[model samples]
Target: MCEHMRPASAFWSFRENISPSALSVTTDGKHTVVGTQNGLIFLNSRGRPLWFNKKIRKVADVSVSTKSGKIAVGSSQKVLYLVNLKGEPIWHRELDSSVIAVSISSRGNLIVVGTDLGKLILFDGKGKKKWEVHLSNSDFPVNSVDITSDGEFILAGTDYSHLYLYDSNGSVLWSKETGSAVLKTCISSNGDYLGYLTSDCKFSFCVKNSRMLWENTFDSQPLWIDMAQTADFVSIGESSNKVNLYNKSGRKVWGFANESSRMGVMASGGGNVILGNKGGIFNYSLEPYLKRLLTGCKRSIIKATEENLDVTESRKIYDVASKNFSNANFSQFLINIHKARNLAREARVIESDSVPSERRLERNEVEEDPIVPQENTEDEMMAKLVQLAEMREKGILSEEEFIMAKSKLLRI
Candidate 1:
């Protein structure tokens, strides 16, 4: 059963049997598509159902091609069903295992699928296999796959606690270790950032080079996260039945909670945010909520470095405050300022300790040649020195002349 809560002004409700495993609301808001656990497909709006899938098993996931009007449904039986807007199946293909997820490239020419056995398959728009990569052994399952908007690279999240990146030609570029099982991942429309949620329920937003831009941990497992291209913000929905909005800097802006609903934030469009839950579908306007939250006293905590400190001994003194402040808010601010000051003082101490001493010898004084030639040419004198040294071994050279030539060579 599905229940829905639309905007108070719209008063729309959508009812369905067997909970939806996945939901994709069209960009135009003219249609919403849902895939159910019973292997059924439904298309509906505020009023009634427009179409349904005929050959139903469990539908693992669904994707709608905005440009081509093609709806692709992946099934637990390892087959993908492609249909037109009218719910007529156009093509179907079988795979080695169940299809867990699917995504269409921005141009809608390629579709990427993540299989149950950690395989990433690429298919053309006509439902022909382009290439298939077995990312891991059968022990691992791929949870999600995403392609950059420009189709330059592909990213896959695996159950073995790793994320794999592949170039356009299917060459492995790089892989990163994540904290836990990666549940879902999404790339921004502009292809500038990628966001992912781990099994531990933490979210990481990263740039192209794998540098983490921001990371946020939730008290409950995150169900889904989405980003907006025009704004430096992301919306995250957690299993605790709360939706929290975060700025690009990783600060929580606002949060809404619905205790009775097992809800998750899906996609935001046309200033309206869409959410899915056991109760059904819900939409909330963003303008009023964003304005009200931004106007409030929404202070964020940030780590401060020594260069950030303006006052002397600020960090040392702030360390003192950290031990004393009973309130977390006030203590964090003081700690940052103190950290900066302490860093400056330490830098000054190091600079003073690095000063050179005046008693050290000059470069020329430490290296001087002999003051005079002893006997023959410079080479003969060295030969004579060697002969005298050998004679001294046989008791031939006198001690005084040997000392004299040695002193001359030593410039003594």
Candidate 2:
């Protein structure tokens, strides 16, 4: 068996008074922009807070330019602000509906905003309105938006369960019905792949042709998702206060948990990840994890071969790992090596038990699903109902909204 190794830990982290509603990491991983319930924050690569702005109230989304570090923020108050690195607003625009999402190009030359009014608007770096398109009715607002690094492509998801891809000029390239409300969406840096999460708790990845590569469903609803530059890695934050990393094939590499709720996550092109919430901003690097995994896999294969155990499957896996390593695809190399090590271990067990070749166990991949919270009891449900009623009385919910929510809560 291979020796155990230490796991990755946060490189740097710090807390704020408010939980982050959204997170955006630059392609180079040098900067991060966070949208909080009551303000916006900018952090450096070392996790030092550079500046904070309380003027951008109830920030729903944030995006940072990959090359220029320009920030575009969307707020629930129906305002979109383009801010400079020093946290000063360069320009602010008010829309007829709530601004829900924003994405800025690499050079900070283009910006896109998705609104509660179901409109997708594009603006130049100087805040000029380039074009606008209404993808759905007001009831089906655009919930997420993403733009390629070069600003040549844009992707948007809606509450109506639709996903649309558009060129730089706002022409629709294609549209697909996702069959569930798309909570969030992201495009790869080169626009080759797209990732999205649905209200049904399913995370999916697809190619430019709209072919779904793979998908996984979680019991706990996801709060945020971001894809790496080439879509080689995907990261997700969940309401369960956990962050997970998955590879292109939908295999989870690891999960990080914390005491506080994790509401936002971003995966940088350089294989770095950042997670944010009321607890703090946590940064992590995948290098350590992948290195240990690769080392352990090599050891396991050697051990199995020395013990004269069946090494056919393990050899094949190792061959693939060699190819990935030759190509400098470290992520895929480590993943394949991890799989090979598991197979090698299984071979040892089968050989020691003298299991017949035909009856050899086929190892099944085990997935660590999120822990589901306990269902509320009658009294607890009653208390929640009372709280909902109080919120409605305070005008937090319209009559139609309140009735709909109550019905869903009561299963009536």
User: Would you list the clashing residue pairs of candidate 2?
Assistant: none
**Model 1 residue-pair collision total:** 6
Give Cα-based local distance difference scores for all models: 0.58, 0.73
TM-score of 2: 0.68
TM-score, model 1 to reference: 0.64
Error of 1 at 239 (Å): 2.8
Give a tens-digit lDDT track for model 1, residues 1-412.
1122222332244644447677665544446667776655554555356867657568877777656787778888899878777888888899989999887665667778899888888887789888888885554888887766456777788898888777667777778889799888876654556788899979987765566766778777877876653234577776536666655445455556544334343332323345555646555444443333222211101111322423335444454444433222222322343344334433432333322111011101111111111233453344334433543444433576456545554452
Evaluated at residue 246, the lDDT of candidate 2 is 65
TM-score of each: 0.64, 0.68
Best by TM-score: 2
Quality of model 1 by C-alpha lDDT? 0.58
Residue 227 in model 2: lDDT = 77
lDDT of 2 by residue, 213-300 (tens): 6778888788888876756568787554566776554556555654344555554543467767666887776554445455556666
Error of 1 at 20 (Å): 0.8
Error of 1 at 101 (Å): 0.9
